[model samples]
Target chain A: MADDIAGRGDPIKTLQLMWGRIEAPKRGPKSKLAVADLVRAAVRLADEEGIDAVSTRRVAEAVGISPMSFYTHIPDKAVLLDLMLDAVARPADGSEEAQAFRPEDWRANVAFVAREYRAFYLRHPWVLQVATHRPVLGPNTMRAYDYFLAAFDGLNLSEVEMDLSVTMVANYVHGAVRDVARARMVKELTGMSDDEWWHAIAPFLETVDFSPYPVASRIGPVVGELYGLGDPDRAFEFGLECLLDGLAVMVERKGGRR
Target chain B: MADDIAGRGDPIKTLQLMWGRIEAPKRGPKSKLAVADLVRAAVRLADEEGIDAVSTRRVAEAVGISPMSFYTHIPDKAVLLDLMLDAVARPADGSEEAQAFRPEDWRANVAFVAREYRAFYLRHPWVLQVATHRPVLGPNTMRAYDYFLAAFDGLNLSEVEMDLSVTMVANYVHGAVRDVARARMVKELTGMSDDEWWHAIAPFLETVDFSPYPVASRIGPVVGELYGLGDPDRAFEFGLECLLDGLAVMVERKGGRR
Candidate 1:
């Protein structure tokens, strides 16, 4: 992400790798490994050991290839990171999950879009840690961007409104994803569930007086026990619904097709 | 974070430290530094460096104290992390910023809450990197939580609805904060603005055919140029407006207090 953001490496080459315009020569090659093999391996390393674990050397070893050979498919760690994320960002078409995301009404489609992206992010939790400001202009990344943009199709949003709507929904989902990922990470790292962790800490908390914070004193446990770790799913639903309603109001105020 | 979640430390001690109930005895041979001094130093380290830069040993050096004495103020790294976040979570009550956040109508108040948090998160970018699922139960943390929950007061929401409302708002704001932070971090780390970075890569993007993504083709450059590395302030306003509208719809739907 740093390398890409810094304008290092060949942008054309990164785009080429992204669009699959260039590929390793198949004939008379020492190995027939595709560029995707490296990206997939890198993704696996990230899923297991975090994004920091993803390196050309590590991925090459995982793919049973040499460092020099790995570079034949992926340009650099930055380009490799770009490809890995685009692979995750690519719409999961033809999968069982994709089937469930079939669009209905505009509102249902909007909800589906949020749900799909949330699931997509969860599947590759480390991807959220990557740079989000400058979305990689890869083919798969473009396809994912199109998918989100089309969610509000025929909804009467102006050009700018359409773009901002997509951005806000994505921001909301990513926020939710971060919360869930935090919970999952804590559990994975500490080898304890939120339930057990809270239970373990309950003894100490029991001694603290809560007379001052009326709202927290009353609602804290109800929320804490129910949502020990943040409940992103529930929060997403609530937020998305409100967001959709808010959009409807704006559209109505603007009054139909412009 | 790992230690706190795993329930390894004395929560009472952490609470005491967080609430300012415990302080180094000042009458003896020890220096005049207080727990706030250590926390303030840690906050500074986290702001300049990342959160990982903060540790008992490092903070002790920053505060001109010994690690043993630092331990006297903080129990462990996890407790230190909790205290650090709680400090960030502490509202800028009398500061000029808080003066602007004076309560108004419910909708205005909701917007204020989101904006306040966005500003708060931006002030301490590293704080967002810490685990967020289980918020530290310190006085400042609870105080912040109370302030959030109170945004919807007298809106006729049930207890559960009121709770969910606050959760969704924080999620949305944090979402916005992440986008802004990503842009800021990229610029700070690379010594190049997103505009400069994009200009460097524009030549490669110019050759691509964006026809398939007509929505992206037309709107991409507009948003990309205007937003550069994600315009969270604009995105937050749009999202918050939609969220407020949506909440109004729900409130109207429920019809009255239970």
Candidate 2:
């Protein structure tokens, strides 16, 4: 044991040394660890084995450390999970660098954010579970929200109205992407693609009498295609355009009110 | 055993009898059991004990029947779950009775439906899990879709556009309500109301510098309020209006195109 300790670094001694450094009466060198590294590994695990595979120990193992060692950096598994969610959702930088932007130019900005957000969700399907519900806010999460809010700064509206507008748009994108991801996952797992799944289920759709409910039958085919195509990004773009146009009306109405 | 069987009416026998009657081996009295009754019982179980508490045996016990008897009317738990989802999402019956209403009049109708849908989800939070992810095409599900699609009639958009429009609106409401319900449940279980929870975590939120990011900080307040407010119905209404306004723009644009 002494030779092992002398020849190779002592596991406990090394841990103690690291712990000493971290606890060192002063913050320096940053322990060669970061929240981003942990989040990145968690995302990788989620992508490889699905969201269910993500656990503090697994993430710690991926980072080559004891599970207990993670607690020094993060509070708990929930914190790690929340951080992972934010990391995946962090918006693309330089969105604002495109200077030709305007506040009333809701269409372009909304579409841009929607596409970016959809891409984020697609890359990390597990994030949908975290995003769709109330979340424990993390650094990355706050940043993404700030970016969205900043995009809407020039639009004429009350603080509350701006808040509501941003919420609606974000929720819409989150919902649409989630549905798309679910369909995709099902296709991947069942070997029955969206089109095949729809074909199999089409008979059931037809057998049901929808005359008393005419609209569903009228639009069922189209809704079917939208979902069946399995392109969340397209859906996000389409819906974002519709929502922004709606907001434009509000902007006009606000202008009139003022 | 005999006494227990007498008291319980032979679980398998009861189910087989109900099944045989419904199937009509020859021409027997149609099974007295109704799908509506089963769905109601299931909903009650979900509401009172949460969705996880719902099961075939529990539902059967609630209805004072054998678990096996349920299969006569519903194929399995999944079918029962689907039926419950449809029941909760039942549409307003008299929507089409107003023949004189114009396309713009459709907004109020859609809003009304949106409100009802939100209430349905609030009343049965468990339904959100199944409804959002699963592709169960039950009668009521079709009927609800038909009603929403009908609201867009005479708008002059292609079938595909109309379908996407309706989906955008429906999905927004569904996703919004799901988020609200989850927050409410978490609050209830944790014994910390939404505001209390936020205040408790405020330090964490403040320390989490998401400045370089925009979406989280900009939208955090709204998301915070959404959770803080005991009722999410108002938020749902606000979002529905935004979505409708967006669709209205599309309708106007299409008319201009024509």
DockQ metric for all predictions? 0.41, 0.24
Q: A1-258, model 2: which lDDT tens digit per residue? A: 000001122122222221222244365555676656777898888787666567778888999889888776765554555556656655556544344445556667766666666777787766655422235344445556666676667666765676677778777877787777776665554466656645655554454455776666666656555556535556667788788777878878887221
**True A-B contacts kept by model 1:** 0.50
Chain B TM, cand. 2: 0.70
Question: What is the C-alpha lDDT profile of model 2 across B155-244, one tens digit per residue?
Answer: 688877777776677678777886687776665544555566456556544544455655445555665565454345666677788887
Worst lDDT run of 10 residues, candidate 2 chain A, spans A1-10
User: What are the models' TM-scores?
Assistant: 0.83, 0.71
Per residue, candidate 1 scores C-alpha lDDT tens digits across B45-107 of 888966656777889999887878887766776777778888877677676334432334678
Model 2 docking grade: acceptable
Docking class of 1: acceptable
Chain B TM-scores across candidates: 0.82, 0.70
**Interface root mean square deviation for model 1, in Å?**
4.4
What lDDT is reached at residue A239 by model 1?
A: 78
